[model samples]
Target: MRPRLPSSPPAAGVTRRGLLIGGGAGVGLILAWALWPRHYLPNLTADTGETIFGAWIKIGDDGHVTVAVPQAEHGQGVYTALPQIVADELGADWRTIAVEPAPLNPLYANALGADELFETARDTVAGRWRDAHAVRIGMMVTAGSSSVRTFEDDLRQAGAAARVLLCKVAAARWQVDWQACDTRGGFVFHGKDRLRFADLAAEAVRGSLPDALPMRVNEDDTRLSGQSLPRLDAPAKVDGSANFAGDVRLPDMVFASIRQAPGGSSRLVRVDRAAADRIPGVLQVVTNDRWVAAIGNHWWAANRALDALAPRFETQGAIVTSATIRAALQGALDTPGRRLAAVGDVDATFKDARLITAEYQVGLAAHAAVETMTATARFADGRLELWLPTLAPAMARDAAAAAAGIATDRVVVHPMLVGGAFGANLDHRCAEQAAILAVTLKRPVQLTWSRVEDLLHDRFRPPAMARMAARLGPNGQILGWRARIAAPATGQEVAARLFAQDAGFRTALALTPSGDPYAIAGAVPPYRMPAYAVDHHPADIGVPTGHWRSGAHSYTAFFTECFLDELAHLAGTEPLSYRIGMLGGDARLARCLSTAASLGGWEGGIAGSGQGIACHSFRGSHIAVLVEAHVGEGQAVSVDRIVAAVDCGRQINPDLVRQQIEGGLLFGMAAATGGSTGFTRGLPDARGFGDLGLPRLADTPDITVELISSEADPGGVSELAVPPVAPAIANALQAATGYRLRCLPLVPGTK
Candidate 1:
């Protein structure tokens, strides 16, 4: 449970940290803003006999250790993985460790996530003291697969500091120096003398920390981090006792069902209040400039009332159809684009050699999480409390505060276990709507979007058209390559909405003077290319675009790997060999390709062989995928087997790594074969999950995953396997049918 923390800022400290006694107004204000000293006290509630140690840990008299986790649990094993890190470092028994969702505090702010959101733009008014400023503003986001990579050091430091303090107290009692003490199995030891951590906790809080924290080195699998520990959250999930946002309940609560404007530059035209009033249980109707809602005691009544009311909306700005979306991308592709990345003079190399060009298309893809948009909110006594499923608790709190016209300090957000996030939890529109409804009704309110509403309002992965151009050397080697992608500046768009003062404004083109590198993330090849260029052509498709699971890497990998397969075929080179030859100094990716080929029984992707190969690098990790697949009757894709080899630096939990890879493979296949929709009159063409051909249990294939063991810093694994699945499938189809399919969803629609 996330308990309420201190809301006010700390008092002034004037030693060398700030000027408090006397100074000019200008100097004092600058010092106060930039150098003022502040301390954040731990607010994680402790039991009667428990004691708080720093901000991240608490210890009970029974030796139970509770650790605070800032990241949300969204199917990934963050709750287990992070605690494993702490347990390993603290030398504590794993059985004694428990997890809690961290409360809002600067000590728990996710700096890595903040950097990811503001990739290339910090030229804002909040640039000064951005770290402190962002934390106070509720920027504690949990996206970007950065939970371990960014927060590991801080978590380890917290554990180590506590361990040292405990040891210091124990050493004092034993008449020994603290530096000669060690911790293991929840005890502090020195020369055959030992003290349990629980016995030292009462006095350890007064001990000072050393200048440098001592870190634990993993020497064997016996260490908790290297082993595959049972998931801490699995028991609750299996017992059906896990609490999500929908499970939140409060006294005197009402349910709401809403319908918002469907298209661009429009608002709610009218609603039949009399018709809604006629519904059996609907108590009231609420209308705003952008949406209308029906409130009732039961959710069904509220939902039924909306159907009877039949609200109408008028849209302008050229009806956004599939044809219009494609045209916008094509127009942008035809125009000159800004260069986001360049290694050498691509134009000069292309001028001397004949250019081989291919353009690939991908339509709009939805997140399709099992749990739709849901939030529970209560507003009373000038304070609002929200139970929300969100990656950014701070952003949701701020947005809800704005929607309710209250101060941010007056709002508290309880981040709940997500049913499925995959980047969908980053948007907080539902939280804002719930806040508005709670304020309007003067009672606790729970708002849920119907499945259709979730699909129709999904900020889709942008529809993009990528033009890939390459010049081959005389000896079957790539001399120069260029990938010009036309898609919305989605990264900037998200950052704009996330960091904007209003929090309602959702455009970033003006804020990002430098072209968005995030739009073309993973566009640069990991191969040894002497010269290549990647450009971004920002297309205004009049449809809101947000991050998908793998972000731009999913589509960009498809474009690069599939086009490289085409080039290999044209040059009479084997697909796997052609890729392995361009490894440069990236021996890790080379080994992944070689291992996958050997294990998957690759047959060179020859005609009628039904074998394919694709590899990619993302988030400091390398992956290679080999699949046995072909087109069946009626052009349906059938994959018989898949083999993946990955080198993700280190595995905090090997089981979780394999789980992510397997889940990502199926997710990417769905995106490639069935996870897309077109727009007609500004509404999504597909309405529900049944329309999207998601994989079922019976459709499973033979799968093998090989995790290379390395002692390097951990890289991201959650989104690693998603990028190459589509390209490998497309490459397999090319080998079997001798026809290159360009667009996504390999069936039905091709742009």
Candidate 2:
């Protein structure tokens, strides 16, 4: 929701002001001159004015408040939710609030996200400042559900500073004590004489801005933060006015379609470029070492020409298939791995007690966003400009510059609205391809990947395999627990892809035993045990892998929670009771688990059906899920209802929170039931949606989400509800069919 220019021209003699806020070094401030309304400002300042506050808030002569949101919005309501925090603090009229995406400056970097990146650095002040500086300059990414959690304080402070400035200006203009004046609903009042912010804008600009201000804490104020404000971007999206990357149109723009190699290990052998150029409306054929694309007047023509040319690719080294991948993972599990966590003597406890061991496997999964990967690039005057949907615009800018063989500053990235991004937009291949094609063609080029190409070329969720062993005491109590997981090191892979030349990141990766936090995120069970140990074996399966929705927790939770369910059954106890018994002191997790059970009617088990429950805590939030499912003929499972209880600290917008929980549950259900991508001879087997079995509308179950209200700091809600779904459904399936399904998808005969 970028700010829109006024429809009419400004009145003559009106002064205009462009407020530019500055931060530490390397935090570039985009000039606000271009954002001002042309007709509003009378005596405009030619030189930009500097303020101590961050570059987020801008007040215009017309009393319009514009907020620069650092996070990319992809139907998550960030554009609205963030502004709500600001408007509430400023006591401004919500109708006058407008939101625009912030520039790729370090000033808007996510502080909380930076903390996650440099956890080891937290102990030292210099290290903490270094991490903060990294976040400020181009490391500003919108991932890990950090949009709201990280920026809430900054926005509130910014808004409060503006309010203080306006109130001071109004009090001085009226020759009254500032303490007697109050600001509310975009107006300054002095004992009943009210003045609109618009009338005092000029005087307010001359007032000194506060370096820092205490944010007002009013739990009862429901106008902004706590209320379910309608999403500002929703109207545009529903009315088809929303502009996505695919909707970008430029003068002399040509469409291009690519035919990529199977995986990173594959190479393009040859392509009939001349034949492709001969096709009707085809402009030119562009080829690199690894892939080729056809530029044409239209996307369909380019796509047809690309298909007509039919580039050939060959695998570089060893051919990898599903069977070969599984064997390699199993082999890695058998080898000695780096121990991530250890407590007490697990070996002795296991030797003295009964052992229950099981191995689980999860296949590679696709992002499968509705919008196909797309980017529009224009090269002119020795500079490049790109419009695309990306979660990491700064990273994309760097990658595009490298691909275009130009200086990073010469490239400008304009992030467009994304249709969806379940961590698929983290890679900048689309932007790189578009830039290269634009440079080669010497014109504006729009490149798009067809559904088949997008699915096959995606940086898929890494395939994982886990082996779990639990030692049980004579009284059905858990004595010891051990887990070993083997999967592609996603941290190493992402580091190599995004920061191959970054010495600091490389050193950090080398210093840490586990390559990435995602490698063993949830490998160790949360429940307390006398002796517990977890190990991770990093594997290179010759397939391109990246972060999925929940990252490593996506599969690790499935493995650990399902194994816990197995242990519960072996102990002849209900899943809920078994979990409660183990959760001795964790009141948060216990509350979520019991709340979900109560709402789901755990005690009233339905005849001809069974219910299962699972809980997990990650990303500073706790969640529990209970699923009621029925098994039909031929072992087909249909979920009747799903109940979830979430404790994400304090709530922002209950409606949006519920939406995220429901969406995450459905997404996880798709993965649990029958969503996967297979490989054969180093090539993806599933070409499109027809083969990749995603959940349909009829498959959606009745979902109920209950959120716990607490005064604790807010946590992420986007991916918190997904991790427990697969295990909960699997447990329910076991209850219905008397079969223990360990692997994902729960396909028949895999029990």
Candidate 3:
């Protein structure tokens, strides 16, 4: 039977009464009914036996209370970090407490994602920090650096409220006045009377939300404000049975391997399925726009059949090679057509003062997470079910629902643990494809993208071309700045959206030079320059683009910091001291710079080893990086040391913060050095690991030092670690060799 087609809308844009408005309303109502206002934080209780220092405590009929968190664990350690908050506040034994992924609740939305909505006017650590608690919409998600900040209030309140409720329950059962019942070590007490929290838990659940709850404080309350605690998930992860998305398997499910056109522009002109069909367990051959799938009883059989299937594609034009993109980027630097930022008399400043200008070219990069893109979808009875690891599942849910012609409520999205995300899962092609095939055949299907296709067709971090020019006064202050950046057309759109979001604030602040960060030294005028201005000229290309680990900030910081270092050298001052002095009024910038410098042992002097630093504030966290590298013979740049410091106020788990920083650095390093997804004549040129180079264990640096300041406002740590790495490394290389490399990858041996 032909699949039932969704009826077309009657009023052009409007669909059938029940299918459009009513269907959406029904879904919304269901969502509302399933969630409650204070639903974000659920109360955990001990049974009938024991309790700890009142924290992580559980006196159970069996003796246990387990904390629950809903944050997605995509290798960022949110699962491990958030529980630390509960343990710290409860003065509980951290070891005895176990944590489970919380059910979907409205309360989960209060953190980082909420802050993103509040940060509409600007994207910065300060912005997120200032509005962390005011917003509400509890849906647990892991994005930005909100896991700790979002749960800070709710979790603390839950623990404190639980304590109050336990005392109330104990006092009522003992027939004593509430005041007479004092609580200590998870037990309620009246003179010569005591009842453990485990015994009182059942009664406590009958009480309402506690209004007044006691708080835990350290010898110095401020010290614990941003204290680092051990990661909660580390023990389980070390014990060997942690479940990742790839580990999931359903009964009677079959495996599939898919192949797509090597050239993105090519379409399937033909498919010779005779040989593939003869394979023992090969179930079917499914072909779509650019994808051809081979389904079999096992993954190996599918893979073998996929390899045997002969398909041909017609090329659109000459392959738009990497050399072409490189050349185009260089050309864009020569003549900028569109300006995104402008302030003061930029032309006058450049013409009047001593200046330097250079063009930097960056290559494509990949999110080569060890786990390839994979998904399982079961389509039956006009309903679709998806099980995959994704960073943006809401969008996926909508897409899957629309495709299946079913109520979104009928679509169930189960988020699984990811081995790695690195911003790649932001798009859900694999899940969509898997669902489409399953729906077409009315059977469950699991599709996996081969590493070759992943590399060849992967959406890459937009390649960028940046032109930097600066004018300095005789007093060692910067007078003017000009930057022209061009990337794929999609980047311009992303930039436009980001720029538009800041338009109102930019107009209100009338920030000098540039309104956005990294524009005119984040508009702080690093070196007191009069008649200052900053401008951006948008250039366009054909490559598809989206956010990488650090997004645009990564490339922007490299250009801004490297140029600033050059300006410092011309002024005859140490780069560290020069930047520090430039940050005259920005205390946040100054603090991070100072801290990072201190961590890197910035004492000056190694004639060839120069210190390079860059500071940025994103998603409510201010981070600064310092790099010390020896750029010796062979043009082989070896970073001897790297120091990263972040002030992301109130750390729930210090170890996770450190790990995120490490991951961000490694991710950024891959982009800076060897990572590339090159194409030719609009066809992918790079095909696999060998073609698309990534940082290997052997390529890792000697040492990396991380220092986090939870004392300050908490902002996101995931991507902040990346933006500064490239610039820091570039600045150090320039300091050491006295020859600034103006392109990415610095080309192994060519400087």
Candidate 4:
């Protein structure tokens, strides 16, 4: 449960805090705007001060402790992780700790948000607090695997400073130096004089606060790394006490279900609202720009109403049919686009050595989050209250405020527990829908998307087609390579630029690959091949392609690693040795490859199973993965084992690292062998679970091992493990059989 802030101001601090007196007019404006809403500009700020949950964390006289967390609790385990960070820092009594979510604070923002807001429209921040003291970015949303990374430093520093302050208070009372007082488990001790945290709370607050403090985050100060600490959310999840957004309930809240246009965009010609009105408990039928929603007393009633309310839409015929899109994407591989990268001269190299060209294709995929799209909104008493769990809150706030015709301040967005958000919740559609309906009805409305709708209306992972051509030197070295890809323009252009600045790669040429792991490898690889050129051309398409875990790196890794295996085979050298020779002295890559190979029993192992390796560096972190698979006579491929090694620099939480690896492996397996968002007649054909074959528990590999380097900084572990899995599996298959499969989800006969 979230903690409640005082709606009314406290008598003492009301004047100083700008509470009741100056706030009422603001509140009135907020209310009036909610009634006749307009787009609400959020008051965003970024706080660089020492943040303690003090206003959030209270020490009762009886020694009970409560810490208020500003972030939402979804499956990411913020509830547990946040409290753990606080408790460890404060040396608080863990048994007596109470955790609660804090309402929006305008003092927290992500690195991505910080970079973006500052990168463009510098004037937008005019007159706003930009300094560390007053610039606190809030509305507390978590994404980009940033919760731990962003808050860890500040919280630790605050805790350490607080402890030092409490000891000073005890020392002052004891007439001793601050160093003489020892602190342990929320208590300060001076010789035999013992003072509980609660007893010194008032004095500690009055004492001088430390403005500068360094966190002793070494291994000696923490037992956090390389340990499988139990997940903080497990108990609540097991007890059914966790409150996902779908579990929200409010007074007089009507239910709503919307049927989106079959085609992406179309004109609504007619809607048969009468049939829906006949449903028991049905309230009203509301039509919006792209969706027709049924409002009813209950969810079932709303769904039934939606079922009966038949609407006709004029199609644009612009929807990309799955088969047509796949074919088109493949054809686009030949079409030229903006040059993203280039290295050496691939055209000249192609004419010099034995060449092998292979094209691989992947299909659209959906973000099958456990909790479907849902939000609750209430527009009453000239105010709007919204309960939603969204990845992108700024846009959500604006959309909801605009829909309700209220000023932003009049609308309050309370992000709730998210069941499972795999990037799809970033869209503001649901929030907009709820606000529009609730405002029209002048009542509270709850909207939940059906499974079919969730899948059909999903912004899919864009289908990708890559044309890779490589030249092998006589000694088996890759002399030249060229890769051209066609897919939706994800933010890869930006990432590629960043990668180039850091890696010295040519960003202007489209075919140049980033961080060519095998480029400078020993003996030139494949016995020895020298001088290579590489580049990439990402074609633009209409499909809605965004970040799907590892982004562009996913396909790039596959093309590079699998193509390496093909070259090794052509040169008649063992794939493992060939890779090792190509990736010399890169200790991180070597560790990962060797660990995966050793674990998979690759050296002189059985011929039925083959092992393949791949490695790449992303966002300063490098990882390598190896896969082992068994191929039977009937064309059935069983993934038997996987081994991965990662050098993330330093480990924050080893358990989380392992979890990320497991997630990446699982998701990659699904994408590699089978899962796809199918389409028919320019519309999504795969509507629900049955149509999309996901990786079931039974399909999981029997053996999986994750090896971490002893010394390294903790890089991002969330999405890095995915890119190598597909190529590893594909390469293994190539070694197992006499086929070089270039497409994803290998069909029985294609290889």
Q: Best candidate, lDDT-wise?
A: 1
TM-score of each: 0.92, 0.90, 0.80, 0.81
Sorted by TM-score, highest first, which candidate order results? 1, 2, 4, 3
Question: Once all C-alphas are superposed, what RMSD does model 2 give against the true structure?
Answer: 8.3
* Candidate 4 residue runs with Cα over 4 Å from true position: 1-74, 96-106, 113-141, 180-184, 189-194, 217-227, 344-354, 492-541, 604-607, 631-636
Tens-digit lDDT track of model 1 for 510-556: 32356677677878888888899999999999999888888888899
What number of clashing residue pairs does each candidate have, in the order they appear?
A: 1, 11, 39, 39
Better of 1 and 4 by lDDT: 1
Q: What lDDT does each candidate get?
A: 0.83, 0.78, 0.62, 0.62
Candidate 2: list runs displaced more than 4 Å. Answer: 1-54, 114-133, 209-212, 221-223, 501-504, 511-515, 604-608
- Candidate 3 shows a clash count of 39
Query: Best TM-score goes to which candidate?
Result: 1
Comparing 1 with 3 on TM-score, the higher-scoring candidate is 1
Mark the regions of model 1 whose C-alpha exceeds 4 Å error after superposition. 1-43, 117-138, 190-194, 218-222, 502-512, 748-751
Candidate 4: tens digits of C-alpha lDDT, residues 1-751 = 1122223333453343353344366433222222221121222221332223243455666665566666555565556565666666666665556665554544344443222211211232221212111123233445445566666665566566667777888888889988666555667888788888878876676677656654435455433334455666677789999777677798887899988876455767778888988899998999965889988888889988877887877777566676667666766666654444455566776775666887777777677777899999988877778888865454467567776777766777777777765566666678888999888988888999998888877766666776667777668777776666666554443323222222211211222233222111110112223444433344444455544555556676776777777777778887777777876466666666677777666753224457666666654466767777756567766776777777766655566667777778887877787667667665677777767677678778864656565665445556667778888888777656657778777654674
> If both were scored by TM-score, which would come out higher, candidate 2 or candidate 4?
2
Summarize candidate 3's per-residue lDDT along 1-751 as a digit string, tens digits: 1112232224444334433444366433332222212212322333345333222223344435566666667778776566655655543444455665553333444445523422233344334322332222222445555666666676776666666677777778778776556555445678889876667776675676545666665445432234565565566568967766556677667788888765436788877799898888998898976878999988888888976787776667555677777777666556644454466778866765666777776777777667789889888777788888766454456556665666656776777777675667756668778877878777787888778767766667777777677777665677677776765544333334222323322232232223233221232233444554444444444565544666666676777777787777788887778887776676776788888888787755235666667777666677788877765566566666678877766566566777788777777666766676667657566777777566678767754645654466566777768877887877777667667776776554343
